[model samples]
Target: MLSRMKGSKILITGASSGIGKAVAFELARRGVKLTLASRRLDSLRDVVEEIQSAFPEAPQPLIARCDVTRRKDVKRMVEECVRRFGGIDVLINNAGTGVYGNAEFTAIEDFRAVMEVNFFGAVRCMMEALPFLKQAEKGLVINITSVAAKHGVPYLGAYGASKAALAVFSQSFRSELKESGVSLMIVYPSYTQTDFFRNEKKVGGARRPRGPYASPQKVARAIVRAAESGKRNLVLSLEGKALTFSQGVFPRLVERAMDRIAYKLREKQEVFNE
Candidate 1:
C-alpha cells in the first residue's frame, strides 16, 4: 500500500483529455506534482495552464510530449519527467486508441495499430518508467485497460483484444514487481464519455455507441483512490463489473449471448446508416 497523495511525483500519459486529464486535476488538488504527457503539446499546455490556474499554490506540472506507440518517445517522456521531478512515484499508462471492425474484415494493419497504442504503448511507458519507478520510495503503475478486456464484443474486436492483452500484462507485471516494492494496478473502465469515439477508427463506417457509459471524472477519482489503496485490479461500473464476472464464470454462455448481441448491433448500425 502507498501513502495518500501528499507530495507524490506522478506522471500521467494521455493527460491532454479524458480520464488522464481528469486524474491530473484530481491529483493536483491532492498536492501531487504532475508530469502530464500527450502527443499534442498544445493540449498538454492547455491542461497545464488550466490546472495551474485552478491550483496556483501547487507545483507547476511538467508537460512532455509522448507518443506511446514509439518506444523512444516514451523513454524521452519518462526521462524528461525524472529530470523535472527527480523521480517518478507513480506512472499511469493511460494513452490508447480504438478500432471498430469485425475480426475477419478488420485489416491486419488496423489490428496492429490498435495493439500498438493500447498494448505495446503501455508496455513502452512501463519499460521507460521502470528505472524511476524503482527509485521511488513507493512506486505505483496504473494501466488504463477497458471492461471489454474481459468480455467479447463484435465491433471492438481489435480494441478489446488489445485491452485484454494489457490486463494480462498488468497482472503478470504486478506479480513481478510486487517483491520489488512496486505496485501495479489494472483499471478496467466501462464506456465513458471521452474523445475515444471521436478518434476511434471505423470498421465499415459510422461506429456505434452501445450500453452504459460513465463520466471520465468519476473513473479518474476511482483511479486516484485505487492508487492510494494499492488495489491490484479494479473494474468500474456495476453493469460492466457484472458482465466481466459473468463472462469469467461462464465463458461459453456469455460468448453465445454476446454473439447474438453483436449480430443485432451490426444489423442495427447497417440499417440505421442506410
Candidate 2:
C-alpha cells in the first residue's frame, strides 16, 4: 500500500490545519505528490514548508488558497492541481465548518452557512474533480464526515444535519461512480481533538460535548489506510463505531443520552462563563 501511495498525486482541501494538515504530512512522508488547498494561504504555506522540511526528498507540495463555498475557487483549485500534478489520483474533501446550538436557538442562516461549507463544499470539489479522478488508474474520493451525521447529537443539530446530507450524498455518489472506476470513501470520526470547536460559528450558548477525543493524526491515518485499501467506508475510533451501532439498535436511547450529555455540557459552560 505504501509503495502504491508513493508517487501518487493527491489533493486535499482544508489543508491548513487539523486532520487535513496531518494527512498532508502523513502522505508526504510516504512520498506522495500533493496539492494542498485552503482558505488561508499563510497557514497553507506554513504546512507546505513543514512538509518540505520533514520530507526533503518528497515532491514539493503545491498550495492554493481556496474557499470551498465558492464554485469558481473550487474550479480553479482543481485546475491548478491538475496543471501541476498532471492528474489527481485522490481527492480528499476535508474542508468543513460547523455551527453549534440547539435547533430552536440556532438561526436558519447559521444552518445555511454550515451546509454551504460542510455539504456543498464537498459536493463542489467532488464534481470538479470527477473528470480528473476518472482518468486516474485507481481514482479515490474521500469525504470526511462525522459520526454526528449518523446520530444527530444534541447541541450540534445544524452541524449534524450538514454532515448527514454529505454522508447521504457520498453514499449515492459512490454507487454512481461504481462503473466509472472512481471510488468514493466516506469517513466518520467522532470528537476529534482539533480546533474545529474553537473555530465553529457559535449561534447559541452551547458548549462542546466532553469526551475522549481522537487525535487528528489518528483520524488522518485511518483515512489514508482506507484510501490505500480501496475501503468503501471508515468510522474511526471504537467509541465512534459504538455510537453508530447503538444509534441503529436503540435510536431513542442514544438520542436521550446525547441530550443529557449536551445539557450537562451547556450547564458547565454557563458556570464557566459566570
Candidate that scores best on lDDT: 2
Question: C-alpha displacement of 12 in model 1, angstroms?
Answer: 0.6
- Residue 32, candidate 1: how far off, in angstroms? 0.6
Worst 10 contiguous positions by lDDT, candidate 1 = 265-274
Compared with the true structure, what per-residue lDDT tens digits does model 1 show for residues 1-274?
4355488899999999999999999899888889999999999999989998999988999999889888888888888888888899899999988987666677799999999999999998888888888988888899999988888676677899999999998888888887887888889998899998889887767456554668899999898888778788899999778888888798888889887877787677641232
- At residue 174, give the lDDT of candidate 2: 90
Q: Which lDDT value does model 2 have at 231?
A: 83
Q: List ranges where model 2 is wrong by over 4 Å.
A: 1-3, 266-274
TM-score of each: 0.94, 0.94
State the TM-score for model 2: 0.94
* Over 4 Å off, model 1: 1-5, 271-274
- lDDT string for model 2 (148-204, tens) is 888877777889999999999999999999999888889998888889989997665
